[model samples]
Target chain A: MQQSQAPISSSSAVNRRGLRPRLTLLLGGILGIILLLDLEPYATRWLQPGGDIIFWDLHFPRVFAAAIGGIALSWSGLMMQTLFRNPLAGPFLIGITPGATFGVALVTYLGASMGLEDSGTSFALQPLAALGGAMLVLSIQLLLQKKLTQLHSLLLVGLVLGYFFGAAVDIITQTAQAQQVKQFVMWGMGGFDRVLPSQLILLGSSALIGLLILLYHRHAFNAYLLGDIHVESAGKSVKNLRLWLIIGSASMAAIVTAYCGPVSFVGLIAPHLSRKIQGTESHGPNILTSAFAGAALTLTADLLANQLIPNTVLPINAILSIIGAPVVIFMLARKD
Target chain B: MKTQRVLSAITTLSALILGLASCGEHPRDANKSDIVWIKNAYATLFRVGYSGTDSFLELYTDAQSKKIAGAFHWGTSAAIQGYEKLKDRSKIVSLSAIHTGMLAELNAHRHLVGVESRKYIAHPLLQEKSTINSLSEVAPDGPILPEKLAFCNPTLMFGTLSSIEDKQAIERQAKGKFSVLWCNNHLENHPLGRAEWIIAFGWVMGKAEKAQGQFNTVKKDYESLVVEAKKSAGTHPKVITNCVYNGMWFVPQYSSYVSQFIRDAGGEPITAENGTGSNVVNIEKAVGLFSEADIWINTDLCTTLNCLKSSDPRVQHIKAFRNGKAYHFNKQLQANGSNPYWDMGCIYPNRILSDLFHIFRDDLPTDSTYYYDICK
Candidate 1:
């Protein structure tokens, strides 16, 4: 029972946590399989002395982006689900993604109107701006959640915030020049291939930081699952824990959205699918399983998006929506 | 006698271009001349009112159908572009008007007989030119309406591919009453190739000799302009065209009209790839291409250098912007705010080439023939 109440290391619970390890390996195996399957052709085409620019510039950067983006969004989704104690809470659903998008659009569209190149270093500060916007929406949602006791009310408020941010983005885009509007609109469509080799370090670092934060609060997360009362009883400030949780989760979502263009449904689908596979409420197995599931799902969606058409990448958001919506329906239909 | 003189001159040019025997296709007998003025080679087929006779033609357009009707018909429908610009307006009959402000002018000129749409009455450009304005008018969003067009009673209708489906609907309504012949001259990648369609149009109007004469002049002028431009080939600058639209920068294909103009003007055109048509690359790729260029031309709809920079500040990063080589087609605007570059330049590519030569080659004599000017 203490194993469920506290965070347990693999050394202390080998036999009892056999499912977690197997689930991790299975999800990890799927991710590996997809990466290898997708990369083998590109890898074979890669010239040793840097002969092929397409292999190096296009394919290699794309693979890492998909993997890293998947991990970040799915892990962020898990954090949001636990923090809100709602199965349906997600970055997109809860206004965090829209806020990040609004932030990027502001710089991309409004900045261009101010005579800044949408393609140049003016767009380089997008992640920070996205983080600010994500935080703005997340803080408002959290503050409103204190008054609105109902889970659906909070979701509704988040949806309203999403609409508001979306309207702001539209207004900003209307004033932008045509090319900037095209860039803004394309960025809204979401794709993995947009991440250049230079952007990978920032994306990878954000994911690593978010994961570390989640791991650091692993114990507090498990305690909070029992309710805010149980978390307080354990001598933790519920408000502080919630704040950190939201910040960590929102940052992860913001970073991914800012770089990859508001990836749809991955944040909502990955955790639920991971929870079903792991079949546990504990943070260690759930988080690991969810992260792997998220990575696997994103990579697979990205692979389908890439391969579905030759030489053209289908939008990642569209592919994810097609794959993610059905799994959500299945989860809702299940008696559990 | 004037027609005979022009015909004789065209006969010489046609003999050189199409061979002597082909030039002799001009009818010799007076009876044949009245019955079939143009030969089948240059003549376009019209539906001719379901009677299977290809004869009379009528044309309608949004503002201007590129002065197409005026070139073929002595006086185009009063509703078309060139009625006032190129033709004797008194000789032209009134057709449907799309803009209400223009409709009042049409009425004042005793030419307001038909209207294409009652849906859109307010036109921003037309409002600026004329006092007669309507609050609400149905604008032609799709093809020319069969009902509105019925009033025009055209034997032949001219339209572009954009209105191909709409033209089909009109064909269905007219069914033997008219034939819609879409002018695909713009599809020609070469400037002369586009202008040469005027000969094809003239043939339809039983004016093949006149069309041939006009085309000969255009050919001679264009070839002379090319020869003048090539003189400064060694000093040609690198030129890029068109500003960013919706974050994707459009560069003319190597074979496009503008690119050909750039080449003939003794300047090298910068393109992302050796594509046959315009390429729409994102801002990043566009920035890379634009940065290396010496001059930028056709920054579409951007009136000033500051406006161009505001569209994308990275425009300032380009050598063209830094060196003040940014130019736009803001020189010749119609009363209704339409760019005559598309209207007039299509007919006179020689002038376009002359302007580019002036821009690219400092050695060239600067003339008042520029269709474009520096974006301040």
Candidate 2:
């Protein structure tokens, strides 16, 4: 119980506490799985062209992408919120999304200047460019997070960096050709459909390892809340802990942005919803709850985007906004 | 005499291209040549109600969404009520290069003074004009600015309902100086229907006879080619088109113009599972269709086999890629990404159909005259 109350090592490893929170995660996960299984865009038995490819190659990879994305964004949001002790804190606040967007736009501009076909296979390189951009900008924030004595300075810097990257994206949009701009816009819409069958291994394993490390050191994130000295006192290498935390959040945001494009609102809304739903002071349920919430919300949004119309695949961002804004508004309105 | 002259010219071209007789079909033989009637042979989105040279033209669009998108009209006919009047046709602003190409096909090139997408204009005539290059991209969120369009001093503007700019909003912005006519030439289900939009463009440009003449010759050429393509020996290859762009794999629908060409060319074309406009699917479904294909066409932006492999590594296993059967229509693409395949290809469906036909057949030469070529 003392370990449970401590800043690191939750004893959440084998504890039977937080039943409702645990159940919420389990049910949310189950619901997510069910929704993913049902995603068959081609109404007929056309999927029978390849044996269970509809599941293995198509839906499986897509579901893996969404789940991983959800976990990454939601966990990153939780980390940001806890470190800042602010409810409004999210991954996008650190300028990761904007930086990633700018990177994608920059690549489009370069390609256009090189006179490459605007809407062609050349877009295959966008994922790499986006990942590189997200990491570069995020690393600056993380380095400052380590160097700066105060969280407020880091927060202010992130806010400013968000603006900087935003202006950069806007500049690119203005100069690029209409066809080239259309490519960036399409990439911004974000979807799980972009994930390939081959990418599941890397994304899935990384997400699993991240989840396990967090689960085993259940109270480690709470120590992250207390900063570097506390993590060192709790028999953990402060440097390693800091590195892990920064890398985890940065990698999650970058990988999701690169593979699935910038999925907005999931990172911002999930942690807040998790805190409200968990209804407890213990940070033990915070990571798992928010990660589950993120996965469930994103999966539902994707399902709705696919099935809302007869044969149309609407943009995921549009559907997420529709689903997320209402939940956020209701939670705020209730203040329950 | 004019009809005879046009027919004679067409006969000569048909004889040169297909080496077959096309004189068997003639509209003037059945109807009075002096009546001056222009009818659409295959277009479904466009309907001409009257028989006279100056008649009401009805445009069909999306009506179910309650956005007020279907069946509009513009003409001088006072008899037809609820139709918008397009008073002046001296100058025109084409939003799409396809329309500009169609107008040029009718020898009404003088009417196209403004265009929203001047960069896409790959026609040598328009590209060499030099003044056409100055038609800047004017719209911020949509396709046109009223002030910029006003600067062009155009009488008619051809717009599409698909853009973010609403038709009513454009009508308000253009005011009386110009009228906005919504054209959905790309949305046509049949290849000939898309080509037949030239006739409507002709009517607007006061070149109805010229448009009809061009449409008739092409239609005859297309049908004859379809029949000739069917006569070739051996089985037609399984055909798939287009590569992934921005995560979505778009293919031609079964009833689409692309599929009709494949069917006519004696080849099997993999079609979208559903939908009419922009057949989109994820990679999984597309891969299922792609693997079954023996030949690929319209591979998006891949000018070479190396480019195709880079777009999707799975193409390496696709029979088309392995056999060097992958092809694209960017043969005449310029440094600025202006491919006449889309510009002129819309006006000449027969040329593309012939290209596909010859490519699909093993005995014939694979190299196309224009538009399509092998991605070596």
Candidate 3:
């Protein structure tokens, strides 16, 4: 039996391919519905004191703040993975979270007696301190690049810095008053719930700037993906591209770390999920997908966390750890 | 000239002999008038098996010994009873009254020289007259500043079991400066010990007869109340005494002074099984033990009805909560105007028993009036 393909059937195959855009729009619409339904009223009631219109207006900024945080962290994850060629890299791995934690602890435990006016200011400045701390480590790694050939050295350095910062935090917490320590412990639980409305502007603006920088350098990102030697052989400046990528990633990491606390695993896992879903090695699709997925995942997890106990809310990190750890493990297993 | 000089010398010699003779006569006269007899009032009043009825006669007889310049009363209720007995005989120049209302009796307005703490130093009269000093601040290591104490020249010091620990320090501080007396009204250190100490204070104040009468009255009243409580004991409801700290509930253990109040009131204490320690137990354990108890008594300083209403939330969970059976201790009974309640009420367990019996025992023939008023 012989089968003959008709010219009309070939044209229908092209039309079916054209329907992919509508399918994507439908999938996005469903996810957007889930996000809007899960987040809006619940976040509104949880953060704002009263159901008054004025209070709801005040709560709007925090919603946008978290949205901005989700985008920045996802984009930062994408940039770091592209630059480092490592899927497990994120703000926490680079010692940024611990560094920021240490800054907050120092101010909380020691600053009051030292006559610091605003204790929360120290917490707000943590990301700046963390950026410096991460850069210092990064610079040290760069300096030792000739001496240390293994990527494990950089990872080990980051680990040691994290432990060192952690020990410093412990010392600060030990001398703190019982009540103050309890508060610090609660904040350390890591959630978007603590972000104030006023911080939205700063978080949103920095995230926008970082996204624009990454978008503008999209060609350089593609060049670097082919390897530094190949890009340099193609007559593009690999060193300049690497520098810009690191700066962009570091800034994005710092902004998110400052506002939303260290949202562990989202930065590491979201990019990988995006790459797998897109089934393409292209950075543009990966970036867009990762941003959407990260926001969706964070919003969904936060929703589940809020709903778990009827009146009481658990930390967002606890939920993320449960969901994120398993997905990352599965992905790694599949890659192997 | 020689004859004139001899006349002058003779006159001078005669004047000197007359002066010596007058001086000798003056000594004899002074001995007769000023040598008053010294009295041992305490020893006479507190003699073995001595009753409190003859306290007045003992005090009057002791008055003939010497004018009592000052007196130190340190015994708890015994001091109050002793002061009342000797109020006419002695001008109580200085006193260290520990109980709340006991200071009101001194009537020496503003004469209170020292206090245990700021929380306990709210007397209007004492506030005007005395410079407040905390017992801890003045005598952290003991031998309370005798010089500071000497300024007031307190002849007597009154204290409860709580102050018993500082007795030696007080005495050392008062050595040669003042006398220290022990008041055992709480009887907490001993069940029947407080009434006996009243006799001792009476003897010290030379009011043995008056102390004996007061002691007899209290003893008789307590015995009758105990009998009444025992009669209706079976109908007495079980009670849990507690206060809130942070979010946790602190239940009184079996052996606390509060437990005695509960038991004497004819109610069984829920924590009675723990056996008389004052350590606060956890809420879970307390709830487990007293979940079925008929009443929850908030023994905190809830002086008013309003204050009792605003008490900690944990109070709402007890069975007593559903029935509104919670009772707060009235603060009015803290002291009799110038006397310490700890010395008086704390030492005299019978009075506390009577109050508790009135509150808890149904159909008990106890005084219905609360000795202390709830703050409200």
Scored by DockQ, the top model is: 2
Tens digit per residue, CA lDDT, model 2, B227-337: 887787368788998786566676777766778778887888787654455566766657766776889998866678877766555555567888898888877888766
- TM-score, predicted candidate 2 vs. hidden true structure: 0.80
Give Cα distance to truth, residue A286, candidate 3, Å: 1.6
Q: Give me the candidate number with maximum TM-score.
A: 2
lDDT at B344 for candidate 1? 54
The sequence of per-residue lDDT tens digits that candidate 3 reaches over residues B113-151 is 444433343444454433443122232222244455555
What does DockQ give for each predicted structure? Answer: 0.10, 0.28, 0.02
Candidate 3 residue spans exceeding 4 A from truth: A1-27, A39-58, A115-153, B1-376
lDDT of 2 by residue, A43-160 (tens): 3454465546555656667776877778778877665666565667776777778888888888878865764543344567788888888888878977776787676787788788
| Rank order (by lDDT, best first) | 2, 1, 3
Docking class of 3: incorrect
| Better lDDT candidate (1, 3) | 1
**By TM-score, is 1 or 2 better?**
2
lDDT of each: 0.64, 0.71, 0.54
Q: Please, what is the TM-score per model?
A: 0.62, 0.80, 0.45
